[model samples]
Structure formats: structure tokens, C-alpha cells
Target: MSHIQKLLFIIALLSSSVAFGQLTEDPEDRRDQGKDPFKTQTVDGQPLPFSQRLRFGGGINGFRFGNPFSLGVSPVVGYQATERLIVGIGGTYNYTHYKAPYYTPTTYNQFGVRGFAMYEFIPSILPNLYLHGEVENSSIQVKDDQTSRSNSVGVTAPLVGLTYSQPISRRFGVNLTALYNLNYNDPQGVSQYIYGSPLVIRLSFF
Candidate 1:
């Protein structure tokens, strides 16, 4: 009778062990199941939370001729809304020294605010390429070269462009973009050296 009881106890223990083993999940499977599909993965192989996927970038241009000097800086902050889409806000400040043939050199300062979006369409084939668009409003102090009088003008510009990005590291990179302004001929628009051209090249860092 004691032998029979011992046999039954051993069988019960084996059954419980099998059941527990079947109920417990593998560690790797558990980790995979817990991952959120909407989370953005960083270049460093770390997962970034939705709120933490903010990026910042900008560009600077400076040039000097014999008598004319120009400097411009634009800074932007963006949020990664999806794996391939980014939306941002930007601001620009530019200073230029205009020296006409007969007139004295006049200093001009311009300030602008813009909203922009970028979408990566062919990331699999070209990971660095993106389509860019922006709408900007600029307030410029226009100075009369001959009269020495100044007036403020507000300009609204809508631009579309393409951007190519080169990544140097996980957090740092460079972007080259060519943009065309749609409202370049607006009568009320401020005269922009960069936007006035058919093709404008911008170098930015992220």
C-alpha cells in the first residue's frame, strides 16, 4: 500500500511540472509581445518614446562680396509624427549690407517664422531622401536707398523642396536641400536673396 501511494505522489508531481512549464512563456517572446508598434527606434538601437522623438535642425549662410555682406540663420524644431513623417516650426533671421553702385551701403534686417513638413517616401531605397514643404511669413524693414526712409513689409511665402540627409552619428548629421518659393512674385512680399532664386541650396545639421 505504501509503494502504491508513493507511485501516485510521483505521478502528481510530474503532471504539475508539465502544466507549469506549458503555462510559462519564454523570456524573448514576452519581450516581443510587450513592445509597442508605434514607438520609434533610434539609430543607436534604442527605443524612443513618442514624446522623446523630437529633433532639431537648422542652416546658416554667410557671404561677403567687395562691398555687400550677408548673413542668415534659420533654426527649426521637429517632432517625429511617424516613422517617415516629421513636422516642425522654424524661425529665420537675416542681415544684409546692400551697396548699390551710387548709393551708400545700407543695413537690412529681416525676421521670419515658418511651419514645415518632411516626408520620406522611398526610405527603403534611399533612406536619406525626403520631400520638404514650408510656409513662411517674413517681416522686413525696407529702406529706401536714396531717401533714407524705412518701411516694414510683411511677406508670405510657400515653398517646396527636396532634402538629402547624411548621418554622421546617431544624434548628429547634415542635410542638403534645394527649395523653390511659390510666392516669390507677390507684390507685398519681401525681397529675399535666397527665395528669389529658382534654386536655393541650404545646408543644415541635426
Candidate 2:
């Protein structure tokens, strides 16, 4: 081959190699893609690696501090929709034993399902503080004497409030939320799951 032709061939080969290398990422770049939180890729306005962005947990539905002794749990599964928002679904099951001065002792069962959302107002300054909202439909089984609606009825409660999240360990955490049910004054007020108060204070764990 002529010297000029040989030189041109080498130049073309080197240029092609450089262009190919530019199209591919190095090992270091791949590592950064996974660990860089702020620069993460997003899917539908949420962070990528959807599975890892999920959190599974539950909350304390009720507890005993007075007359009607009760205990319950609200298991939830959530997705980190964004850096500051979380959305999830949960279910509740509560048992209460009420004993008053003149009335005979009785046991009540409450079960329900809820959809909830929480937004962190100041994640950088107060990472644990959150504004919470939810809507729940509860089925209560009560004696005919208690409610105007025959025996068993379903009540819908729409609530909005605040939450404080405390992470105990890598795998465990606690959430304290206070919610006000808008339907608290409905006809089924007597069958309130969290006592008879409109102001509900809840402490839960995951």
C-alpha cells in the first residue's frame, strides 16, 4: 500500500475506536448511577429501581390507656413516590373489651382498610416530620341496642393529619400520627374504632 493510504487507514481506525468508547460507560459510572441519590433516574415522577424504593411496614392501630382496653395493628406497604412523598395501603384489626360501672362487660371487633399518603414538609431540616392524609372504610359489628343501623354496618372515615416517623434500626421503625376523622359525627359515632373521639392519636411500627 502507498504511505498516504496507510496513514489514512490508521487514522480512520483510531477515530472509530474513540467514538465507540464514548458511547459506552465505564465501571465507575455504573457504580455512581446506583448510589447517587439526588441524581437517580426516575420513573413516572418517582425514583428508579422501583423495588428498592419500596418500604413494608405497619402501625399500632390502638392501645389501652383508659376504660375500653384495646389492641390492634395496621399493616402497610408503601412506595417512595418521590424524595418527599410516600403512598401506601394498610389494613386494621382491633379488639376492645369495655367494662363500665353498671353495664355488663362486652367485647367488640373492628376491622377496616385504608389508603394513605404522607409528605415530608422539611426533609432536610426535620426529616421525621410529615403531613399525613387517609381515607378508611370500617366495618363494625355491634349489638342492636347500640346503633340505629340494625347490627353490622360500614362507615367511611376521611381523615387528615400529621405524622412523626422515628427509625429505630435499619429494619425497624415507628410512626406517630394524629388524624381527625371528618365523619366522626356521623350516625355510627357510637361505633368509633378508636374510642369515641374525633381526634385520634396513633403510634405504629414497621
- Which tens-of-lDDT digit does each residue in 104-157 have in candidate 1? 656677799999888989978988699999888888876767688887778887
lDDT per model vs. reference: 0.71, 0.71
How high a TM-score does candidate 2 get?
0.69
Best by TM-score: 1
Model 2 whole-model lDDT (C-alpha atoms) = 0.71
Scanning candidate 1 in windows of ten residues, the lowest lDDT window is 22-31
Tens digits of lDDT, candidate 2, 1-206: 99999999999999989765643323234445573233123322323555555678886766775667788788888777766787889998877766666444556677899999989898779876889999988887764333433356688889999999886642235889999878888785644644567777788775
* lDDT score for residue 46 of model 1: 45
Listed in order, each prediction's TM-score against the native is: 0.70, 0.69
